[model samples]
Target: MTGLGEDVPQTAGAIWRRTVPVWAGLTALLVATLSLAYVPMGRFGIVVSLGIAAAKAGLVVVFFMQLRKPDPLLRLTAFASLIFVAFLLTIIFAEVLTRAPPTRPGTVMPRSAPDMPGLGQRAF
Candidate 1:
C-alpha cells in the first residue's frame, strides 16, 4: 500500500501555525512554574511542578506533532511512547515517594519548638 497516498503534502506550515500559540502559552507557563519553585509548597510542590511540565509536553505532542490527524498506527506509536514514559515515571516516583527527606547536619529544629507545651521538660 502506497502510504499517505504516496505523497503526503508535508503540511509543516500548518503544524507551525497551530503550535505558535502553544509555544507562547508554554513559555508563560514555564516562567510562572519557575516562579513557584521559590515559593514553598513542601511535598505537593514537586507534584504540581511536574504536572505543569507534563501538560506542556502534552500540548507539544498534540499541536506540534499533529496527533489529531494521524493514522491509527501513528497514534498507537504516540501512545506507546506515553506508556513508556509513564513506566519510567512510576519507577522514579516510587523512589522519590519512599525516600526520607534529607537530614541537615546541624541540630534538627522541631517544627513547633517555639510552641511546645514543655520546652525544657525532662520528663512528663
Candidate 2:
C-alpha cells in the first residue's frame, strides 16, 4: 500500500487530458483581456479587466496550484489572504478617490507674500 502523502503516478496522456482544457480556457481569457483594451468603455473598463483577471487567477489557483484537494485549513488560509488583499485595495482606492487634487502651475492665482514689500505693487 502507498504511504500517506504519496501521489499516484499517472501516464503523460492522462496528465495532458486533464490539463489541456484548463490551458485552453486560460488562453481564451487572455485573448479576451487583450481584445478589451481597445474598446472604449469609460469607467467600466477597469471593472471588466479586473473580472477577467480574477477568473484567470481562480483557474490558476484551483488547477496549477492544486488547491482543490488540499486540507480545509489551507483553503481557509488562502481565502483569508484574498480577503485581506481586497480590504487593502478598497482602502487604497477610497483614499485615492477622496484626496484633494494637487495644484499645478497656472491652476492657482499668483499671490504676494504678506511680509513682502512692494512686490505686489510692481507692474509685470
Tens-digit lDDT string for candidate 2 (1-124): 4332347567898789879999999999999999999999999999999999999999999888777774677689889999999999999999999866657554544455774457456432
Shift of residue 90 alpha carbon in model 2, Å = 4.1
Error at 86, model 2, angstroms: 2.6
Across 2-106, the per-residue lDDT of candidate 1 in tens digits comes to 453337454889667766889898998899798998999999998999899889888888776777664788799999988998999999999999866658466
Model 2's TM-score against the true structure: 0.62
Give each prediction's root-mean-square deviation over alpha carbons: 10.5, 8.5
